[model samples]
Target: MATFAMTRERIFRELVERSNRSGNAIWLARMIASWRVGEGALPDYLGLSPEQFNNLRSHCFSDIALPHLAVSGKTVDYSRMLEKQDLETLLGDFRAPDVAETEWIIAILVAGCLGSDHLWQDLGLWSRSELSGLMSHNFPELAARNNKDMKWKKFLYKQLCEMEGLNLCRAPSCQVCQDYGLCFASEESTSVIDQVERNFNRDA
Candidate 1:
């Protein structure tokens, strides 16, 4: 498994390097290469319309293809994020001052909000640090506010909760909360990106 892990890691690095390696390309490549959205069509999982997906595919993954994408139609509808429009607006407001196409990223992150795992895992991003990098790149102000390094999903929802003047978690003080681990715990031992690389090497 260790040997295969290295192979997977090398394969992933090569794929990113082979591509343009722009921040957008790297993020898209990580998600696409991860292949972890086991239950939905790629575009829907990525919170993108078919047109948007196609454009990104052409620009970022032109040299790589996946069977998952060929499975057409929306397997799951993440459109109704349960009254989370305010959250979307907040994300947009903090988007990087100099970047383009961040709205697409905001849409993707909003779609990811509907998942049960960590936000990065839900987005098939492979690692928490990668998610952090993306956030720092595109939502620097908001990301900077996460001084305690709270989990991205928890942090985002917490931010949303605070923005709406609600304390849904009911933990006015996190230090005393029983679910502190849920907010600040470390990720699992294996990077899901390894799984993505395995799948990419096997199927792409």
Candidate 2:
């Protein structure tokens, strides 16, 4: 049994390494993360056996691909890829009213900023007020519905950092819960949400 497990682990690690080199590791990791492999059978969505899936989950690490994902490049405009519908779908799983909108907005903003080289210059607004105005124009109902008296820029920055942390710690075998380390009740995980909240309050 021990030998079998070891061999499986080796295979999983090799697969991950290959994926990292191919620059598809982020996509692969996201697929694994979405499947929630620890609790049930490996879904047919990935077309891998239960044992193989579990092995990947147990051995996979974000360090292999997260840095590349986080860094900005000229090839693709990541910000433009952050569609509002996608953000809504991603945050739909969250139950908390206060946190959900903020989280979604953050994800959208981070996805936009991360891939833009001249983010500041291109956007043409450094202060929170200017940024908030832009957000209000782009996502009109968001602020009015949330009823949160926070500066949009600071809130956006806080949320983006939290998203980055979440992206960094994401793995199939992560100690953190599926809430992406944002839920307070997840004792097994580190909550980047708390850090973002603290930063927001400080900036406020």
Candidate 3:
């Protein structure tokens, strides 16, 4: 069997290569690549299991991306989220004096929320409040980077809404706001996103 480090390295390299070949955005590629490597190594590094890694990936692709796409009006084709040209345009439009910090925030949010189970389900019921709370408590640095007038919950909700409007989530939902009712259930369901988020929060 390959050593954990070696497996992680291989997985990372494969993800990078695949992303490059598919013309995936660098940031998106990095996010997935990290998960691919981390999922493989985390079990050995921190006593997780292969099943957990699979669950993490499932939650990410489904719960995180699904609701996001619903709200953002974005469509994902195959395994691709943002097209290369569109991603380039977005990167250009959002250019800042400190690009690194912006990138870090995006990366952190993608890693934390996309891989989380809690953010998905019945129209992402727990997403806004719980995730906002988690960010406020665990990632104060991220919270500090936002404009002073922006509250964490407000920021997260706004971003999610924007992403939905942009159709970045996959297949965007078209119903008018007033016509839509919450799709998520108040109680726990057997959703992968929910399970992973619960596990992550407990571990933290």
Local accuracy by lDDT, each model: 0.69, 0.35, 0.35
TM-score of each: 0.75, 0.23, 0.24
Model 2, range 127-182, lDDT digits (tens) per residue?
Answer: 23434443544455554432444433333444445655644435563344475333
lDDT of model 1 at position 51: 72
lDDT tens digits, residues 112-191, model 3?
Answer: 33222333221222234443443434345544444432434334544445645743334244243332233322324443
List runs of model 3 lying over 4 Å from the truth: 1-79, 83-105, 112-116, 120-130, 134-179, 183-204
Top of the candidates by TM-score: 1
How well is each residue in 14-89 modelled by candidate 1, as lDDT tens digits? 6687676667767766665544334212344366766766666566656755343422244446456564677788
After TM-score superposition, the amount by which residue 167's alpha carbon in candidate 1 deviates from its true location, in angstroms, is: 1.8
**Residue 149 CA displacement from its true place in model 3, Å:** 17
Clashes found in each candidate (C-alpha, N, C closer than 3 A):
0, 1, 16
Q: Name every residue pair that clashes in candidate 2.
A: 79-112
Q: C-alpha displacement of 187 in model 2, angstroms?
A: 30
